[model samples]
Target: MKLLFFVPLLVVALVASTFAQQASWRPVDTKILSPWAAEIDPANPHPEYPRPQMTREDWVNLNGLWNYALAPKGAGMPEAYAGEILVPFAIESALSGVGKTVGKDQELWYFREIEIDRSLRREKLLLHFGAVDWEAEVFVNGQSVGTHQGGYDPFYFDISEALQSGKTQSLAIRVWDPTDEGPQPRGKQVNEPRGIWYTPVTGIWQTVWLEAVPEHHIRSLKNTPDFDNKQIRVQADVAGATAGQRLRIRLLADGTPVGEQLVANQEEAVFMLDAPQVWSPENPFLYDLEVALMDGKKVVDQVNGYTALRKISTARDANGIQRMLLNNEFVFQYGPLDQGWWPDGLYTAPTEEALLFDIEKTLDMGFNMIRKHVKVEPARWYYHCDRMGVLVWQDMPSGDMGNRWESRPGVIGKGTEKDRTPESEAIFRKEWKAIMDANYNFPSIVVWVPFNEAWGQFDTEEIVEWTVDYDPSRLVNGASGGNYTLKGQIMDMHNYPDPVMPDPQIWGDQQVIVLGEYGGLGLPVDGHTWQEKDNWGYQSFKNETELQERYSRLIQDLKPLIPKGLSAAIYTQTTDVEVEVNGLMTYDREVIKFDPAFLRNKHQELYTIKIPMK
Candidate 1:
């Protein structure tokens, strides 16, 4: 959130030619070489259900195309639309059909018209945006309906009152994203992108749609799977309902009823399952769920959902060293440092297939986990992780205050820790809690990381404890690879181009040893980079063969550390991010740097599961 100051002399010249050329961008037909390049269907793009965990078959998909306009700094709503930008892609992204940066001072607007069915008109109409970066003010039928400020979480507005009873309705949105110029949790976005920091996303970057629900509908459902108790707690947050309203929750395994429970109002109800199938990397079993809101006897609202059975905790191993236990067993966690960047969509994936491709590739490479570095992904991303058997270390998007060059170092690391102001601390806490509340239901997310490499880090001990209390079921990485007070589950370290383990003496009993981040082996591919020059990685390679060889050597070196009590290691990244050309895959997902089978075999060799009895 701390604004970076740039001297006037440092400002690059505005190249009108580049802007003009990119503004007319559209999703290219992938019938040629790169078949994986996301294709835009004129009739149905990203028509699949957005929220896989909580799905309803009756909802409409509003994802093909929409009217878009970019107004000047502080300009009011425009009278004429500039052009058609694809819905759900950020205005700055190539897939949006309008690849133009929305600066801190500018406003990005979107307008779309939709018709409601007479059957749906009987129910309340709710408009949902999977996510809109920074700040968004929404208008329904020319009247301001609501305003929401948060980039990562989904939000909705009830527009039943504003709806035209028997005609088509209009929805307009005006968004303002300061990116790194404001004190909000803008993940890795920067005005002048370099290294890990990449392109900024402004306006709607996720699915936007409408759902018709009864007046007293089930607003939100939070399901917590407790393997320790062998029970799944279901909590329904109902809207427009009274105290005595009854809701029935049914749990099913492979579509067969396993358990059922009836609860009233917003209370936590438990459904006990017999011999529950616990979720793990090898077998990620999820139980189907259905919730119905009842008004006396008539069913008023219903929502279909799912939950996984899993547990994460810390326990001392045979050597008296603390270790992270998944499903009650010590498993050495090895995963990529996922930056969650898309070549075409920036923060948003061009298509759902593209989103799943990253996860599938990660799994194919023989890693069972991924440290989702500094960003929270869409709910469906986590849902895929749950289904595909991958563990996730979720980092709370950081904000507040820090020096770009100091706190976030390039070649060297050195920074004076600045105390966070009371106001900044309050905002940080609010956003952190909101993020947890939104993502606590995910089973694949076994760890909650509060700070990364000391970026805007403050009150480490207290915040770590707060995270532990917030969700006792998961482990907390107090601080990953930075100024550490040694107060969390993992004593994390960051050593790029080389791997390093925390001192066993200092954190022998307090925390599990982990190489939080390492091995940024860079290989930039031509015509697939955000910028030609100024690209970097910890170690740069000329081609894929060299990259794979160096990566295999790094993994071989990591094998000795596991016996030394190193429980986990997160490699630099899963895919190339903007200027950081160090990933298993290229930025556009056009190349796989290493052979998946070979990489998997190398990773499996490090685990104790395959070690011979000598």
Candidate 2:
């Protein structure tokens, strides 16, 4: 990926003073904080290029300090903002500089002066948001540009027309997030926080930036890998595409050209690769991708990306028991029910390093997979997983989740689906598809989890059927620990403290058996607790030694179950969230109760187990 830097001399001289301007800004007091919190510089918080999967050389970062205020939902823009709130951090977060909640009746407003370098704003200037909670309406220099809904997916507005003829432009955004009050896809967020639910995250919680592209530019890319055919299929979208427009796609392995293709705009391009290295936990080889829009001979737009070859499916074993297969081989997937959260930032991590730390620590502790529990992370998180060889079971964040997990002997989890209004259903459908579309390119994601534990589980058969129809490339976990109709490729069961699998004697031949959740062993370190007193966990231990001993026994109990039919298993979580202390690491991420070497060595055996065949 190429990142071209061209900082003018005048701007270079003022860069040093930017940090000093925010010297007084400090993270509000929290019960605990990650090590990265202390190192945050407001001038360039989360300075890393946000969209690693889609990289452009010339772009301006629109992060840092921004004036913000809370107003009544129906009220117009505030006459005056109370103070500066950090962009990309939720207003309810300690890192946001204004730790306050914006309930369903209120709307959060943000205003910031954006400096658009005339040189960088060539033909088109687009404002990009990694994500904004609930709904957001954008205004450039007080001119309404566009409005976007859905809190977890990325969106942008073409602000080129709204730009004023001035050195700096005014940017304002009005956001309304209902958290649990509204029927949106807000995962694990509640106004009244306790037990499994945490504090509400309102307004912007991810990177906001600016990009420069030609009039006719590549808007998005969806690359699907055909492992059986040894080819990659691409569906590209170009904004302002005109007649005679063509897209050039080139593939490279270690800088050596592998293949190239030129196709007309809006056409799918299939590039061949002979015997490419397959991506897996063992070898996560990524090939460079160069894409460009060609107007005659000259390149109108270009963006750099990467991809890999991988496949996921299920096959029956000799004993007529279905098993999960990755790249045509049976490898047991075991990982944590990773609830991505931070004590300081809540839904947002303090820094990119803080985000990468969770993935790195998960791998260090010997897990190859992570069930991104009921949450969608920033693009960079998936990019890290793709590069680091960590398999992801991406969950659609649960919302409108009051339905009971009702089921009978058979008949597609009958009487369990929620009778949601059409608006709620549409919101779920639109957001789920957007999330899938946004994250489809990453090979790390092997399974798509539509509903979790019957929360917002509606139209089970239709939803699962549609998911399979939409993208047949990956397996679908119909309802992870939810109302399982046995329609998807996986039949997951939720067990606590002890590991268990769906009985192979009965349901083993129909779908891949898995322990969707188990092993919630908790040991909260003193001084690192989210609160002073009560904390929650499925099983609590007094000391580190006791926690480690019980975890070892849990794994000892989990291994033999794989031979019967268990395809995969997910532990409770990666880190302690709020009062739930079941994580391997503490909420502050200051301590790991188990030794990494011992844990990894113990887990390594489960991957080698094989079921007997017919």
By lDDT, the best candidate is 2
TM-score result, candidate 1: 0.90
lDDT of 1 by residue, 1-614 (tens): 11111221221122223234444444532111122332545345677777777776567878867888878766877888988888787887766767788888788889988888887677787788888997899998888899988888888888888987667998889999888887777778888876567778888888887888888888888988888889888889888887667999899999999988789878787978778898999999999889999878888889998898888887877767777788778788999999887776778776678789889989988999999988888888999998889999999887755733232212223344548778668767877887888788788999989988778887878999899888887888887876665566777778877777766665757888788888999887765566767778888988877777898789878888787677889998897887788888777676677878888999888765421111
Quote the lDDT for 171 in model 1. Answer: 82
Alpha-carbon RMSD, candidate 1: 7.0
TM-score of each: 0.90, 0.95
Best of the candidates, TM-score: 2
Given candidate 1, what's the lDDT at residue 260? 82
lDDT of each: 0.78, 0.86
Candidate 2 segments exceeding 4 Å error? 1-21, 406-415, 612-614
lDDT of 2 at 13: 39
